[model samples]
Target: MAAGLAVTLATMTMGACSGERSEFDTRNESFLNDASPDAPAPGPGCGHQCSLDGRSVINTCTGETVQTCAADLACGAGVCQPPCAAAAADKSSNGCDFYFQEPRFEYTTISQSCYAAYVVNTSMQPVEVSMELEGKPLDLSRALYRAEPGSAEMTPLVGPIPPGESAILFISDKSPDTPLTPLESAYLGCPEGVVPASYVGGTPWGTGYGVAFHLTTNAPVSLAAVFPFGGASSAYSSATLLLPVPTWAKQHMIVNAWEMFRDGFGPGAQIFAAEDDTEVTIVPSRPIQSGKGVTGAPARVPVTYHLDKGQLLQIAQNEELTGSLVSSTKPTAIVGGHACANVPTHVTTCDVLAQQIPALEQWGHEYVGVGYAPRMGGEDELMMYRIIAARDGTRLDYDPALPAGAPVTMSAGEHVSFPAGVGEAFVVRTQDADHPIYLAAYMPGHGAAGGIWTGSDGRGDPDFVNVVPAGQYMSSYSFYADPTFADTSLVLVRAKTNGEFKDVSLECAGTLTDWKPVGTRGDYEFTRVILSRNYRPGDSFDGGGTCQYGLQRTKSDGPFTATIWGTAYCVSYGYTGGMALRKLVEIPLDVPH
Candidate 1:
């Protein structure tokens, strides 16, 4: 999808190839020296899936079956995947192994949630995925687990997540049909001119767990954690798609937002180790809370500790941890955010914020920023964005021209904030791929600057989202949408294939009819679609609301990016639906000479 930057990797061979020989010449030479017409006919097996007839391999993708690889594509990963998919993080999320951390979520009052995971089977064959909890107190009384409305049940599910169907593994209550509310939560929306929890500096009063789950990722599947129930379990509701352990790395930077009141936890970074005796180090962007024996961590000072497999440690304090660097003797995953936060320090309503931080290596230099759907105000919504530099002298340039007030450069570990208005699509890029940057989109508190902006979801609060860069997009995606909020929508950015825009479709909504063209930096475009709205909280999963939450998939002839957002009264959660955590190189289906 990043045609402009991607084309560079494809051109490196040219410098020493002016004397290149044609395919015919190469073939002639091979024929002369290694002719073998007497050999037997070629077999039907593909290289990776040799057991299956390459002529009729399983599509593996949703709603598709047996098919041969396209002429230019090779059969891999059980289907005809572009050569580039071999090393990208897109398909990596569906591996047969995954390690998930049951994060520490805090609230102001009566905080209790059905901690669960929404798992979607992305493989063709049925797979029995199971879980092994790392922490105890493993009591399963009235725990909700269901895949269909008519077949709701309590206790652990009998079978797998099931192919083509989605399953919610609830940790409490048996409500396959409904979610909790804020007033129901005995919670209050953040008010303007209020002191944040970080500034006020108090201990976390909300419920939090130190558990971890080792999912037998057998068969391909993708997962997302719905904070509590899919509903406004805590109008402080927030959720994020979880990346498989295979996509995690040895390094990560905690991306934090403005903190909340002193009651809940302030800006923090939680690190989970996958191996025993993993020596973890944290260079805090702010003072670190003394917890779990990490007693003397301070801002800018590196702290080291050991964690066995399945153990998690949260380092938090009164200051933000946005640029903190987390390194480990082994690969680890870091979930960063405030238990609840004001998007900007000067905002009103606060919302829970958290996202699995991608390893620095997975960051990209190019991106397209889009705001969450605008259901609260029929008009296009505005978003605040942050560009974090992973390397020094990271210069940023905006397509069509840099927006005023936007910084053109940033230093390593430094970040800049800028506003992106409605109905706008702009391309942001660094000098090259080496200067990768991380992008985070933010929704300011509804009562930001003391201005009233309330509607369908009530008085919305501040929220944070990790923006998936164009360079990390994959052709197809199978993600989850929480049906607990009043509204849910998607933001998609599509890049051209062979110099022309290709169509992208959402499972709930067919072919997209509206797309705003991104500048002339290359052939790029973006669109915002509201998947569901005006639905009562917590009823979508039970067939009573306007939105049905579950396995939501999207596809295009070429790679593209997608993000999902859910909004409730004074509450919302947003996260990129999926992305390829960069690893391998170029992805040109048709590499040129």
Candidate 2:
């Protein structure tokens, strides 16, 4: 399966390079070191090899051979660059067709004040992003991630978002009681008038609500929604990467962090359709809420339903949805998360959790797992990681092994989890390409029961982020780190040899240095960097902000993936920095016969 796909990817990759690259088919066949072996070896000072493009050393650049550093150490820009240094080699999260679901919270709370945070325009050309409901576009959007609620600043998108930046648009304020006395502000987050009156979210459980965003760009871009409910202590805030349409699949298995919170947000899956009359079949691992046509179905039994374009089917249940199966007749968007959750369900506090389910084709056989930075206690905390198998008898081999009782194998719809200590990393590989699996990383709240929750003592609450596959690593990323987050830090992994060059760099922080290899693993290394402390809007800007998010850009010499995390005052948010969104398999959807 892997070899076949590689051939297909190579074929799809040939003509896609050069000129303004499209969002998909950006793959480039590596031509580095492909020059004839019969060619004479260069003389001294040939270490700094150069090329006209990124892959091959076969082209010419202004009377200079773009191969093996024949003469000069390096050539001019766009002339002879280093092998694999072309921006096209980056497998980034730039695509259209994204889905977002603001989990239900108290209608009159901060959670109701949701926004489409961090809509990154990763292209050179400006791009526009808009929200669509029930198949029609909504005239609402704004450019503020941490705006003062009720400031009336979160308005509909005004103009095109500049290239290589991010924008935050006010999604909606579900409170019907929003103030109206000549701009009278309700205690909720935003005024009712800010969002369309008809589009009411934060609805009661069992009332499936659907919302989608349509980006008007063929250029590569990425997006996420910030559900920062409440403020200060005990608040629940988390974010999810909005996988683009090209990555959407006909089948996906659910992976909720943990069981739901009693009388609070529970584990659930949100399904959205882009085409009308789409039939969705779901076999629950846990019983779904007995309504919305789910009244008679039980766990482990397939339940089918039909939905139209821009419609959503939210499956909420008292139990976690991990290990469940969802398959659709048409390409569909699926999100699985807990509105608020405690890792292990007994951690000190709970935080909202959401991550878009990558299509089966997006699942990878190899992964690198690393824990977040050390906590305030000075002890590198233990992070949690879960792997869900998409196929039966999927054997797993862990480099440096897992602590104690981590599973070495998983069956389809089965999930295995373990704790990762500070600096400890796990490089996981399955038996073969046929045994693909999904991985998710989670940071538990500061402590278990009896831990401090005060403003001055307690630090991070529970947070969640998807573990992108090594196959999907991108060479560059244009992402965001909300200034509202007190601690904005980055965690990333790359080839060990790549780290030896120390080429990773951030926009504001300059070049990244000191990469420690993962465990005793010789294949890869990982590192963490703090972007800002107690980030305040406008306090730290990249000198560009017209709906473009913080506009932070990070690049490397080779393919790598990073996770951006923010933690402070019992609230935290995390999401994959960016990815190439590579599809690995082609599954023929067999709609109910």
| Candidate topping TM-score | 2
Query: What are the lDDT scores of the predictions, listed in order?
Result: 0.56, 0.58
Best by the lDDT measure: 2
Candidate 1 lDDT tens digits, 551-581: 5778776668888777666667777766766
- TM-scores of the candidates are 0.74, 0.75
Give the worst 10-residue stretch by lDDT in candidate 2: 1-10
RMSD of each: 12.2, 11.8
Tell me the tens digit of each residue's lDDT in model 2 across 256-283: 7666656544666678787889998888
Error of 2 at 246 (Å): 1.9
What are the runs in model 1 whose C-alpha is more than 4 Å off? 1-91, 105-110, 135-144, 147-158, 172-209, 259-265, 378-380, 448-459, 536-549, 584-593
* Steric clashes per prediction: 11, 9
